[model samples]
Target chain A: MMAVVTVAIAVQGNLFAVVVLGSIYSFLMATALVALDAVDVAMTEASVGAGISTVLLLGALHLVRGEEQKPRGRPWLPLAASVVMAGVLVYGTFGLPGFSDAGAPIHQHVVPRYLNDAVRETGVPNVVTAVLASYRGYDTLGETTVVFTAGAGVIALLRRRRRDRRDGDVR
Target chain B: MRNYLVLRVVAKIMIPFMLLYALYVQFHGDYGPGGGFQAGVIIAAAIIFYAIVFGLATARRVVPDWLVETCLAAGVLIYAGVGLVGILLGGNFLDYFVLDRDPVAGQHRGIFWVEAGVCVTVAGVMLKIFYMFAGRRREDDDA
Candidate 1:
């Protein structure tokens, strides 16, 4: 947490800072996932979040310069809003389960069986895969659809407007 | 032009080995930390390397836009098609027990096919994005 805060502070005034911070946060989250025994999720986060997202963002940065255009609006409203959000989130966390509480409802749920028997049933050593592909396969299917949708969106966005106009002109 | 020669030679040497490793990882995921996603990225990275080295026109010639689109569709179709097969065989959706007489073997079969589909889709998407970005960069460079 302290390291994340320091990194965030270091990147406070840069556009690429957000990307760096996000990548760091992702890697940290991947570590957290590993601690939680979700190795597959951790792997995905490490690869997709830390690796791919950073590279994609860098590519985008190459196209669009990373320097911030000077702020043209009053900062108070946004600052106050963010503060309120932070406060509410912090307050909400007070009532939430403490980390690593063995007696927590989450620990007592059906997930324990998933953690234990996933390998035996799915024949996959990665419990995350067993759960993702077997237990919640429908959700995974939906995720695939979302990815397809994003791909379609990119194609649509990147389609040559001039090409369309040219086709119309020919017609 | 000077850098191109080096990139082309390195890519030529590396791509085949990288793709071979991807296939290996995809097939060996049942026993290791590798899977469809890893294989997909590795393969896509190789293609991106090829495009960067040999030029987008050449890369696209090797793997045309239509092929990428088809791969994207085919992956999803394969996944859904398998589930539909299960349904047709009188089981719940994706219930692999109906895929074969033995339930365990059926699960393996289901996972293998689905992972393959995932690999295809992911690789296509990655290459698609790389092409988009690289094409954009080329346009910018030209201008």
Candidate 2:
């Protein structure tokens, strides 16, 4: 299902179709993440990747031409580069510990504390929340800063109207 | 789209529910498979749906640009301020243990505020990006 959407998005000539297909692919990916038991990650993917991004893309489409232009040249070099990178990644993953392996390096480390003692220590029944907002909170703080930065960047770039565009020009 | 009766009606009906669900997700994140990031995007999605059905002007009126700008910075302030409180309480930065006399309760307090900050910022950014793109199209139309 996802592969079909991926190919359609790549081959579709109409920009709108591509955007819709991309959204479908994101939904499929979110479903797969749920199956993998990463429900939090899945929700993020479905909402951010599928829901909000589709709207953003549509807004973008309204600003640009509706049709995707044909490629001017073959993409052999990039294709080979991507294929090689994919193969390397796959080969690297083969050496990883088996799924749910207890003796895995990660499980042997702070995972134990987060799993066993997090609830008791944090008084939060949800270990994910305990870890994200309490134990490893600094990381989330940094991520929040990054999200704000993105908003700031967009506002700076787009706040000027046509008349103000001339006035705001530094050059 | 403006003249499509069914589309407008459905969007109007769904927008409120979407906002409600966003709040549910934001508040219930502590116990479930959700958090600020997911809930924030959901809130932005609700407003974007409204803008599509009604108009950008209406949506902007509902969520003014100044409000978006404030949210964009306020979330970080909240998260950082919470950390500052930890320092003021004589613990290291982001030290939840020092937040309250009871360390466990302090952890809960710290996490709640931190998550709230995340939700606010995430929603703010998502809306800001969407408004920037969509508002540009509106300006082009006006010109």
Candidate 3:
């Protein structure tokens, strides 16, 4: 099913179609995550990726006309670079621990403590929340700051008034 | 067009419930998939729906610009204050253990307040962004 969606999207390269397909892909991935019991991450992905990001992108499309433009030249360098990266990833993943292996080092180490005592420690029933806001809080704080900085940049850029061409008066 | 009055009436009836549910998600985030971010977006969506149907002027009247700015700053300040408490208690940065007599309880206490802060900031930011975008539409229409 996922491959069908992927192939359909890959075949249809129009901008609007791409956006809709991407949104579908995002929601599907979120559903897969939920099925794997990563509900919190799934919720975040569905909301942020499928909902907000897609809405924002569509709004941007409204601002900019959607006309298909072809690249001037073949992007051979980027394609070759990505192929090398994919080859490295495939080689590396072959050496990875089997899926859902309890004996994996990840399951044995930091994850065990979070799984065992997250609720008792953080007073939050959502283990993801406990880990996000309590155990790994500094990282979340940094991410929030980055978002704030981006907002500030957008506000500064857009808040300026430009003179009207017809009226010879400032907006 | 006249028949759409029913839609308006339904929206008026439903919006309050939506806002309340957002708050419920914000506070109940400790137990469920929801948290600050989800709550923030939910609140923003409610407000956005209002603006879409009732007009931007109505939303401005409801949320007001200054309150949004204040909420954003207040959330960050609250989050930072928790870390400051850790510093005052002679623990490393954001060490919730020293906030209370019992380390476990302190951690819980600290996490709650910080999460609350995140909720406030997120809600504020979401509203602010909506206003900006909605405001742009007005400008475009004027042009």
Candidate 4:
């Protein structure tokens, strides 16, 4: 199902349909994450990817042509590079521990401590929240800063365009 | 959308529930899958839905640009303020353990404020982006 949506998005010429299809792809990906038991990730994917990005893309479509333009030339080098990167990524995954292995290095490390003592230490029933907001406070702060920066960037770009247009009118 | 009575009625009914759910997710994140980020997006989505149905100008009137901008900065301030308080309490930066008389209570307190900060900032950013895009179209139409 996800693959079908991705292929449709890739081949679609209408920008609106492509945006909608991309959101569908994100929804499917979020469902896949839930099936994999990453509920937090699924929530983020659903909200950011499916919900917000779709609106942003549709807004962008309004500012530009809806139909995607045909490529001026074939992208042989980029295709080859993508293939090589895919192959390398596939090769790299082979070195990973088996799925849900109890003795995986990751499980052996901080997992035990978090599971056994997170509630006692942070007093939060949800270990994920405890880890994110308390144990990993600095990292969460940095993530918030990044989101702030993105908002600032969008404001700069969008607001400045309006200002420039107004100045041009004055001239 | 303005002429479609059914659409407007349904949106009117749903918007409150959507906002309520966002609040539930925000405060209940400590025990569930949701957190500030998800809650923030949900809140913004509700507003955006309202804007889509009732018109952008109406939505803007409800949530003014200045308020949204304030939220964007205040959230970051709240997060950093908590960290500063921790330092003043004679602990390291962002040391939740020193937030209250009891370390466990302090942890809870710190997490609550930090999450609140995250919620505020995330909601602000999402709304800011939406306003910029929607307002741009309105300006273009005016010109």
Candidate 5:
């Protein structure tokens, strides 16, 4: 299902349809995350990908043409590069441990400590919350700063465009 | 959209519920599969839905630009302020263990405020981006 949606989005000519298909793809990805038992990731994917991005893309679409233009030429070089990268990624994954392997390196390290002691240490029932907000506070803070920076960049660009329009130099 | 009474009415009814759910997700994150990021986006989505149904001007009137900007900064301040407090109490930065007399309670206190800060900032950022895009379109229409 997700593969079909991805193909549809890739091939779609209408910008609006692409956006809609992208949203659907995000939804499918979120569902896949849920099936993988990564509820936190699923939630983030559903909200950020399917919800907020769809709206943002639609808003952006309003400022641009509604249809995608045909490619000026066949891009064989980029296609070959993409295929090579995909092959490398697939080759890289071969070294990974089996899915849900109990003795995997990751499970052997901090997983036990977090599962056994996170509640007692952080006083939060949800280990994910404890890990995100307390154990790894610095990382979350950095993530927040990234979001802040992106917001500032968008505001600056939009404000500059408005100013340009006011000065009769509209693009 | 303005002429679509059904859309307006449904949005009116749904926005409050959406907001309430966002709050629930925000505060109940410690026990569930949600937290500040999801809650913040949900809150922003509610407001965006209202804007889509009732028009951006009306939505902006309800949630003024100044307020959104304030939220963007204030949330970061709150998070950093808590960390500063930890340092003042002779602990390392963002040390939740020193937030209260009891270490466990301190952890709870720190996590709650940090999550609150995250919620505020995330909601603010989402709304700010939405405003920038929507407002530009409005200005183009005006000119």
Candidate 6:
């Protein structure tokens, strides 16, 4: 079903349908995340990917025509490049431990400590939150800063538009 | 959109709940399958839904551009300030254990503020991006 949606999105000429299909694709991916027990990620995917992004994409679509752009050159080179990249990635995953292996290197490193001592140390029942907001505080701080930068960048780009439009660079 | 009576009425009903759920996800994150990022996106989506059902102008009035920008900067500050406070309390930057007499209590305090910062920043960015894109005149309109 995911594959079918991808193909539908790929072959669809109407940009509006493509955008809607993309939302469906995100919804499907969210479900897949849930199946993997990544409920946090699933929630983010549902809200960010399938929800707000669909609205954002529609806003972008409003700026352009309903149809896909005409191809100006052969697409085989990019297709071949993508295929090669996919193969190499698949090949690279071969050395990973079998699914849920108890002795996997990742399990050995920090998993036990976080599981055994997180509540005792941080008093937060949710290890995920404890890790995100405390143990990995710096990383979350950085992420927040990145989000701030992005918002600042967008404002710099768009907020002064009406005044700048008379300069003839944009319509 | 305004004339679509069913759409307007349903969205009017749903928007408040959507905002409420976003808040729920924000505070209930530590106990549930959610956090600031998800909650913030949910919040932005609720507003964007209003922008779609109503009009961009009306939506902007409800969430003015200035307020969104303030939230954007303030969230980063709140996160960083928590780290600085940790350092000032005789621990390394972002060391939550030093935040209170009880390290566990400190951890709770640190996580709460950090998540709040993240939620505010995420909500601001999402809304700002949506507004920027939606506010642009459609390319075909003038053509």
TM-score of chain A of 1: 0.78
TM-scores vs. true structure, each candidate: 0.83, 0.94, 0.85, 0.98, 0.97, 0.95
The weakest ten consecutive residues by lDDT in model 5 chain B span B134-143
Candidate 2 global TM-score: 0.94
DockQ of 1: 0.45
Residue-level lDDT tens digits of model 5 in B1-143: 98998997898899999999999999999988898888988999999898888889999999999999898888888888989999999899999999999999999999999998888889999999999988888776776
Instruction: Write the residue-wise lDDT of candidate 1 on A1-171 in tens digits.
Output: 837655674547676887888788888888988888766567678767876667677778888877767679868898899889999999999998888788889889888999888776767776655565667767766766666677777777776743675587789
Tens-digit lDDT track of model 2 for A1-171: 988888788788999999988898999999999999999999999998999989889888998999998888999999999999999999999999998888999888899889899878988877878888988889999999999998988887676554486576655
Q: What is the TM-score of chain A alone in each candidate?
A: 0.78, 0.91, 0.85, 0.96, 0.94, 0.94
Residue B49 miss distance in model 2 (angstroms): 1.1
Which is better, 2 or 3, measured by lDDT? 2
Per-residue lDDT tens digits for candidate 4, residues A20-62, read 9999999999999999998988999999899988998898788
Top candidate on DockQ is 2
Clashing residue pairs found in predicted model 3? none
For candidate 3, what is the TM-score? 0.85
Docking quality tier of model 1? acceptable
| lDDT of residue A153 for candidate 3 | 61
Query: Could you tell me the TM-score of candidate 1?
Result: 0.83
Per-residue C-alpha lDDT of model 1 across residues B14-121, encoded as one tens digit per residue: 999989988987887776666777777778777766776777899999999999988777777777777898899999997766777877677777877777777788
Candidate 6: residue A34 lDDT (0-100): 96
Span of 10 residues, lowest total lDDT, candidate 6 chain B: B134-143
Native contact fraction per model: 0.18, 0.95, 0.36, 0.79, 0.78, 0.88
TM-score per model for chain B alone?
0.91, 0.94, 0.89, 0.97, 0.97, 0.94
Where model 3 places Cα greater than 4 Å from the true spot, the runs are A7-14, A75-80, A161-168, B1-10
| Model 4 residue pairs with clashes | none
Error of 6 at B124 (Å): 0.5
Query: In angstroms, how far off is B19's CA in candidate 3?
Result: 2.6
